[model samples]
Target chain A: MRELEERIRREGRVLGTDVLKVDNFLNHQVDPKLMVALGHEFAMRFADAGVTKVLTVESSGIAPAVFTALDLDVPMVFARKRKSITLSADNYTADVYSFTKQETNHIIVDKRFIQPKDSVLIIDDFLANGQAAQGMMEIITAAGANLVGAGIVIEKTFQKGRQLLNEANVRVESLARIEDFVNGQVVFANED
Target chain B: MRELEERIRREGRVLGTDVLKVDNFLNHQVDPKLMVALGHEFAMRFADAGVTKVLTVESSGIAPAVFTALDLDVPMVFARKRKSITLSADNYTADVYSFTKQETNHIIVDKRFIQPKDSVLIIDDFLANGQAAQGMMEIITAAGANLVGAGIVIEKTFQKGRQLLNEANVRVESLARIEDFVNGQVVFANED
Candidate 1:
């Protein structure tokens, strides 16, 4: 966790007040070693939660989810934003509003993937508004699966995404929680 | 490779002419153990290629790309179709046509991710008509990097994807090459 905070301090780019671009190691480009370490950390943190499956949204969330799933020795499932002809007709879906893209897209998980007997953990890169995590939680509820918690790489606490998930009775464990960006520096909640 | 072939033969579903869905493991819901095995196989095949980076498009490609990058001990980069506010403006992009989606979308990679000193290996879930691979190849070319080859999980050989990449002088190594789905059974090129 300290290493992730250090990497964010070193490589994360803060644009305006909310956007933290981790170009050098997370999102877009990735360090696989770092990803593996993150996965191990998540597994270590939530080992007793009885997680049977790892869930995430497509694109940016897939890498960490895969590594986490591997560390947990469980199956990984990702919700899709883009509709594919090859995808089945039966699915559980929820709308996620992205402030970055300035749009709401329907994120879907095939009904066949999630089961009532499974315990699911949601993983992702960043949690800003918590819209994506909330959407994934809805999918988990729809499938009748037990929601363990969310494992996020970075959470912008100022954006109040943590409050959103906590209100929904969802536990969030972010490796790095950014309290604010002051003078082009990332400030962590626990640092000072 | 044998295990992959077995998985495709067992779990892969044939919907129509070319729609082979491995919903149980490959896409949608994924088996991390199988993915790790597939990654190891790909690494074994391209072990001597001097791969500096592993490149793939986002969503479905990210899982295998992560595993492949871990096995190769290199960083991974995924091209994005959805625009994000955090994403940098300077990018190298290419238009990729998705036959399943019946649309062409622009895929982008940040200019700083891929460099001239890099030797990129494109990894993906499938190679149908190879448009995605071609688009990724263009991104590698834009960076002035050497393209080692494409490591594909599955290839519908009848679709002539192999021919296209071969014509472009890019080597392709598919774990399972489908000759065709005969009588609802996946037929491999080497089996016959």
Candidate 2:
């Protein structure tokens, strides 16, 4: 977490009021060593949760989720995102609205991946509005699987996502929590 | 390589004559240990290439690319795919046509990620039509970066991808090379 926070401080760019671009290491251009550390942290935080599977959305979440699954010695499932919603009998689908993109996209998970016997942990890059996490939680519920918790790489504490997850009764662990972005600089929550 | 071939034989589903659905491990629901092994293999293969960065497309390619980068001690960059092309001055873009989806999506990489002094190695989940690899190569060329080669997790020998890469004079290393799918069974090109 310290390493991540340091990386964010060094390379992260704050655009406008809330947007934090960590393309240099976290997403887009990834630092694999940092990802390993992030994944190890998530796995350590949820070591006793009986996590049978690690679930996340496609693209950004795959890097962190895969490493977390590796650390936990479990299978990682990434929910596929579709621009247009398509109903399928073999898959559990949920609609997620991205506040940043200002568009609604459907997230889908194959029914065969998650089951009633499995306990799932959600991993994501950024927890902004919590739409992506909510969608994964919906899919996990539909599969009759137990939700262990959510692991976020970079969380915007000022946003509604953290509170939303709390209301849903999901345990959340974020490596780097942004308190606010003021004058093109990031203010982290729980600064050490 | 034998381990990967074994996995393909056991869990891979050949949907039709040509399409091999490896959603169980290679893409959608990923097996992290297997991915680690694949990445280690790729890293060993390209260890002498002086790779400064590992490159791949988003979603499926992130897992392997990150691990490969980790083993190689380099950064990994995944090209962002856009449904609608948006020309930008800060990014190098290439149009890739997905044969399976029958749609063209533009893959973009920021100019800051790929530099002229960097030696990039392309890593991907599969090599079928070579569209994704070709697009990455174009981006590498545009950035004036040195391309060591491509490390493919699975390569269908019967497809035009291998021939296309060969024609392009790019060295390719594939962990699992499928000769054909005979009656829903994968035939490896090199059976050791």
Candidate 3:
């Protein structure tokens, strides 16, 4: 967790007021060693949750989630994002609105992957508005699966996403929690 | 590689004539241990290539590619797929046509991640039509980076993708070379 926060402080760029660009090591261009560390941390944090499956959104979440799943010795399932919704019987779908892109996309998970007997853990890159996490929670509920908790790589604590998850009684754990972006610099929470 | 072949035989769904749905392990619901094995195999195959970086497209390619990069001790860069193209000066973009989806999407790579002195190794989930690989090659070329080779998880030998890469004189290593799907069964290229 310290390594992640250090990497984020060193390599992450602050864009505008709230956008933190981690393309160098977290998102677009990934540091696999760092991802492994992050994944191990997440697995260590949720070691006793009875997690049978790791769920995440496609693209950005795949790298960290896969490693987490590997350490947990469980299957990792990524929900596909579709710009246009096509109603399907085989999948449990939820609508996720991206505040940055300003568009609504449907996140879908195959019904066969998540079962009623399974315990699911959600992993994601960033927890901003919590729309994506909320969507995954919806899919997990629809599949009759038990939600263990969420493991976030970088969380914006100033945003309303944490509040939303807390309201739903979802246990959320983030490696790096950002309190605010002050004058083109990141101010992490609980950092003296 | 035998382990991967065994997985394909057991869980892979041969859909129609040319489509092989590996959503169970390689794509959607991923088996993390299998991915780690596949990634280790790829890393071993390209061990002597002096690979400074690993590149792949987003979503499906991220899991295997990240592990491959980890084993190789390099950075893994995933090209972002955009349905609508927005030309930018800071990124190298290439158009990749998905034969299955019947749509053309742009794959964008940041210019900062790829350097002219870097030797890049492209890794992907499938090598069917080779459009994604070709696009990555184009971006690597545009960036003035040296391409060592490509490591493919599954290759359809019957498809034109292999031929295209052959003509381009790029060395390719596929873990599982699928010859054909005969009556809903996968036929390996070099089965004894």
Candidate 4:
């Protein structure tokens, strides 16, 4: 977690009060070494949750989900934003509101992938307003699967995402939680 | 490669004549162990190329791209399907035609991540008509980067993807190359 926070401090850019750009090593361009470390941290945090699978949305969430799946020795299921022709009709879907994109899009997963007895660990790159996490939970609930918890690499604590997930009784673990951003200076939630 | 071929034969569904769905392991639902193995194989194939980065498009391509980056000990840069608030104005954009979706989408990569001197290794889940790979090549060229080759998990030999890529002088290494799918049976290309 310290390594992630340090990396964010060194490479992260603050665009506005609401946006943090970490494309250098987090989302668009991924640092696989750091990703593996983050995955190990997630596995350590949720080691006893009986996680059968790791679930995430397309694009940005795939990296962390893959690393966590490797650490937990479980399979990872990513919900596709657009349903291609190759996708089967037997799928569980939920419309997720993207705060950044300012639109709602359906994210889907095959029904056969997530069984009723499985416990899924949801992971993502950023947790802003918790819309994506909520949508993933909806997909899990639709499949009659259990939501183990949510693992986030970077979280904006000033936003209501954490509150929303907590109110829904979902345990959330974030590597770096941003308390506030004032004049391009990031204030950590728990400054060590 | 044998493991991947076996997975496709067992879990892959053949839809009509040209579609082979291996979402269970390759794309939608990813097996991290198998993905890592495929990544290792890619590393072996492109070991002499001096790959500095792993490039791919979003969604399905991110999984194998991550693993390939891990194997190559480099960073993975994935082109986003759409422009978001997080994406900057300075980017190399290319239009990709999706045969399955029957539409053209613009894939963009931030200019800051990929430099002119970087040697890139492109990875993808499938190479059907080579449209996506061609688009990625355009981005790499625009950035003045060297494309070492393409590492594909599955290639439909019956399609013109390989031939098109070869015509473009792009080296392609596919783990499983399908020669034909006759009467619900998969015929693999002769391995060297």
List DockQ, one per candidate, in order: 0.83, 0.95, 0.95, 0.87
Q: Which ten residues in a row have the lowest lDDT in candidate 2 chain B?
A: B183-192
- For model 2, how does the per-residue alpha-carbon lDDT over A1-192 read when each residue is reduced to its tens digit? 899999999999999998999999988999998989999999999999999999999989999999999999999999999998669899999999989889999999999999999999999999999999999999999999999999999999989999999999999999999999889988899864
What shift in Å separates residue A118 of candidate 2 from its native position after superposition? 0.8
**C-alpha RMSD by candidate, in order:** 2.3, 1.0, 0.8, 2.3
TM-score of each: 0.96, 0.99, 0.99, 0.96
lDDT of 4 by residue, A1-192 (tens): 789989988999998887889999988999998889998999999999999999998878889889899999999999888543244569888878877868788888889899999999999998999988998999899889999999999999988889999999999999999998889977899974
TM (chain A), candidate 2? 0.98
The docking category that best describes candidate 1 is high
Candidate 1 residue-wise lDDT, A1-192, digit = tens: 999999989888989877889977888898988988898999988899999999999878877888899999999998888442244569888888888978788888889889999999999999999999999998899899999999999999989689999998888999999999998889998987
Tens digit of lDDT per residue, candidate 3, span A1-192? 788888888999999999999999989999999988989999999999999999999989999999999999999999999988778899999999999999999999989999999899999999999999999999999999999999999999999999999999999999999999988888999787
- The CA lDDT at A70 in model 3 is 94
* TM-score for chain B of each model, two decimals: 0.95, 0.98, 0.98, 0.94
**iRMSD, per candidate, in listed order:** 0.9, 0.5, 0.5, 0.7
